[model samples]
Target: MDFEKLLVWQRAKALAVSLYKELANCGDVAFKSQITRSGLSVPSNIAEGMERFTNTEKRRFLSIAKASCGELRTQIMIGGEIGYIPALLADRWINETREISKMLSGLINRISD
Candidate 1:
């Protein structure tokens, strides 16, 4: 399957782009870099996983992508708590990551079967 054709991947990619733009003016460089890296990883891993020949490899990458969702969520929460990211923006990202994680889980299950 084409990764770009997957809704999960599409959403993840959009979230990553949004994050990059949102965090562009953030003064906390370290936090910004970390969150952005995880945001980027979601789609990157999904694409790499989908292109793999084996279901196991694909699932592995998908799992990584899913984990990155949690990582990104945590970062967003921390950023919001520390005033680095606005509450509304953090809430949006948190929700997006949650959806992405669920989508990844469904994909993983499909592949497993």
Candidate 2:
């Protein structure tokens, strides 16, 4: 299946785009870069994994994507605490990361079986 067709991938991509837009004018370059990179990694790794020929490779990439979800969630929390991200928006994004992580887990389990 194409990664683009996956709901998780689509959501992940959307979240990353939202992050970029929200942080466009952020004064702290380092924080913006770190958060955006983690957000982007979710969909990017998912796409890369789905395109791999082997299940092992696919799982590896999916696992990386799952890990990125956690990383993104952490960054989001930190961003919120540090006043970089708005409260509501940060909560929404954190929830999204959790859902995306669950979706990635499902995909990994399916591939494993």
Candidate 3:
């Protein structure tokens, strides 16, 4: 399947872009990079995984992508707690990541089965 065409991917990509903007102003360089990297990684990994040569490979990458989504979730929570990210913004990304994670899980299950 073309993950690029998937609504989940599309939403994740938009979320990533918004996240990029959100983290850019964060004063801590390392924190911003780490969070942004993992945030961007979620959808990118999903796209790359879909293009893999085997379903096993796809599953592996998708799992990592799901992990990245989880990482993004944690980072957002931490950011909000630390006052780096606002509650509303954090909630938006959290919701987007949760949905994307669910979609990625469904894709992985279908590929595995």
Give the per-residue lDDT of model 1 (tens digit) for 16-107: 99999988998878888999999999999999999999999999999999999999999999999999888998898899999999999999
Model 3 misplaced stretches (Cα beyond 4 Å) = none
Top model by lDDT, which number? 2
* lDDT digits (tens) for residues 33-87 of candidate 2: 9999999999999999999999999999999999999999999999999999999
| Local distance difference test, candidate 1 | 0.94
TM-score per prediction, in order, is 0.97, 0.98, 0.93
Candidate 2: which pairs clash?
Answer: none
**TM-score of predicted model 1?**
0.97
Error of 1 at 98 (Å): 0.5
Give me the overall lDDT of model 3: 0.87
Residue 70 of model 1: what lDDT? 94
Alpha-carbon RMSD, each predicted model: 0.9, 0.8, 1.2
Evaluation by TM-score, superior candidate among 1 and 3: 1
Supply the TM-score for candidate 2.
0.98
